[model samples]
Target: MAKKPEPQLPLGSSSTLRGLTESFSFHSSPESFITSRILAFHKEHPDIVDTRAVVRAKVLNRNVAIVSSHAQIQQVLANDAAGYEAGGAYDELMAPFFPSPNLLLTDGGKHEAMRRTWEERMGSLKENVIPLVHQQTTEHFSEPSTSEIDLYDSMKTLSWKILLGTFLGLEHRDKLFETTEGLQENLLRGQFSLFPVTVNTGFWHSPRKKGKEAKRKLQAQTLAHFKEKESACPFATTDDGALEDIANHSVLFTSSLAVKALASILTALVLNLYLYSKEDGRSLAESLASESDPGRRSQRLRSILLETERLSPPIVGVMRRSTRENIIPSTGEQADVKIPKGWDCWLYFVGGGRDPAAFGSTWDAFDPERYINASIPQGAAFGSGPKACLGRELIREIALAMAETCIGLGIRMQGNIAARGVRGWLGWEPNDAVKPADWAQDMKQLPTQRPSEPVMVRVARS
Candidate 1:
């Protein structure tokens, strides 16, 4: 029997397509954009045994590891929690957008302290949160008419309102919304301007300068709101008997990027439902409405949400920085790869979800029943290990409730749906609708996932 040819690592290739098809190329070349480059890289490099798949690369003049294997990615995340603190390229890149030392960029004691405050408030606030989610869902999403909808835009507006009014208890929700509406765009525009190669990294230049200015303005608004003491701030003042923890307030507020994250997930859910239902000769809204038992409906909805998360995660990958030279804990064949200190490790979390070894033969297909019945290894949906996203539960509650509400209201979604972006930043682009100028500008904020073409959907009441 003839042996299969060894796969080549993504190295120098003549054609951009050839580079992406043959090996793992991270940057956007003339032949392809960043989103296509990333997708091609992931699709081709599923297994880690091929050294070419998980090889090292230089990004922004720093040593970097492009990890695709589930075990290797998990090990990197564990290593980060242990010693590889968050400060490095990502910190420098995101500094203009995020405040100094927040949860996303902090490690050790400070992160733990802040996380505790967040968990305490978020966990106990369910009574407050669930009701607010329902209220917001009704207001923004429960309309009973045949109005065309842009799922991405509509969901963002809904999530932002919930975050400000319900989660943060801000009284000036409308004013804050108008002011910070451009927040995501400014951050994305700045990141893109600084690092034209990719949407994730950037330098301290005009784009970043503009993003920082916008961020500072939002932070000031938050500060003034706190000073007024009109409403309680969840993270600012906690009942945990710990310190008054005021320093990380801006970081906490800025973490509303959770809004974008949830919006992406919900968009995927809607698209999947619309496409799949059309295949079975029954509308998703009809099927959902037919289920009279709330418990069964909830379970099915959760399964669909999980499946969407597994098949199409909102964020493509989670990044971590190595604080010191160390041996990354290994799973299979690549245990000996030594990661040098100061190197950035990119965990393709979504790639892990699609790992054939982990999920069996049907890994690529969208099958919610896999989640409902099978015991699949819980891939990094929200994330894995210590630094996993803290707002997973909040996102789940809001997304599930919104899905259930929309279905119950007999809302049917129709349009051309395509996934666009690198990693979990993939946003839905409905091809049938024309792009609006305001919508296009708003999407500039999250170019990584939100496509240049507006995602216009026809939302009709059944």
Candidate 2:
């Protein structure tokens, strides 16, 4: 028998296929443009909760309709999510940058199991590692602030050190300090992906993939180091005593991916360090600066990050797909939007972070003070609900540390930096498929913690 003809997709679906194109600009690709566009659109068209636009594409996919309502976004992240498989699409799009496979790539049992492992390691880190956070930050901040310095690069150095120390628990963890330093240098250039589909597709995009490979090699040695210690005794075996949870070998392997995830965390703190140092942010920073209190600093930093996340979310939005088919629970009169299967769900973290319905009047300004006073839940920064950012503790700790260090040491920005947002692609993940020379020139600041470009800053004792 002859094969039956397959049903055709809508012509508009094919020829009219346009991804969220605005997210990726050719000539001038500043995140501010993308953020303002989507946010402005949402602000004007209140009724249309989910506006269809060409934000960016993932591999073969395009024309993603970005949604800002928290509820709409949440529906996509739900494990019982019915309409689509966001992680799958994300994996397809970003796998080249993060091929090692970790918590963010998949959903269901395996995702949960790995996530639990990661959570345990992180939760267990609070006591043992938090003190180090204080110690290092305090020491770094103790010095007098004189010359200007790239605040984010400085923080990235600290964040990288802290993460390697706490998570990897490397012996003399600072040894590998520089290893994670410039991780974001060539990484953000991947932003051109949404537009430069040709180059990014071939061997041109391989730094992140190479990083993953390096991590895999390191994992073996790392695991050997840990196993020997475990065979001798458990890491939590000390007295008076802080509990030291050894990052599992499995985590060691998964770290190949985790470090890439960390680019967002690193980038966020770096952005905020300079942003909060600005005139607009100084008010909130001033409030915390005078306190000399960790709790107060935490509160202030939370506000700053929320505002930053609202205005310049590093990961602007998370891509999610429904795991189970079901109606989303809602408060309004109408029922939840019917989510069909296999749809790409884009959560407007940037949208909800700045939602007028959620934030009310002062939604537009860069007001960190709102987080301290307003009722808007500061949940979107690391996400909320069941799948909240598991790395939230680290995000908070690192951000707080960067802020406190600035306050105590009086670290000033030697030069101006933009706390701008991200467009087509996240800036942290590298395109491993591409050769280093093919990418932009690697700029240096710190011999170890160099960023993509030389973000010039001069520094001295405060």
Local accuracy of candidate 1 as per-residue lDDT tens digits, 1-462: 444343333321234335333322243221122324344555675453442245455554555566656666777776446757665646666666765656777777878887886677668666677777777777775466466667678877776777766544644355655565566457656654534332333644466667667667766666565556536465445433322234234434434455677667777777766655535688555676788888887777787778778766767676777777756544444335666676677666556776666777666566655667656666676777777888788778877777777776667667754433311222133211213232333333232234345678887665
**Using lDDT as the measure, which candidate wins?**
1
Give the 10-residue window scoring lowest on summed lDDT in candidate 2. Answer: 419-428
lDDT of 2 by residue, 110-198 (tens): 66676786676566656666666666666655666566655445654555555566655542245443443333333333321344342
Give the Cα-based TM-score of candidate 1 against the true structure. 0.77
- lDDT, each prediction: 0.59, 0.47
Query: How far is 89's C-alpha from truth in model 1 (Å)?
Result: 4.2
Candidate 2 versus the native: TM-score? 0.65
Off by over 4 Å in 2: 1-59, 78-87, 93-101, 113-117, 138-147, 171-212, 228-286, 292-298, 322-339, 410-462
Q: Which whole-number lDDT from 0 to 100 does residue 318 have in model 1?
A: 68
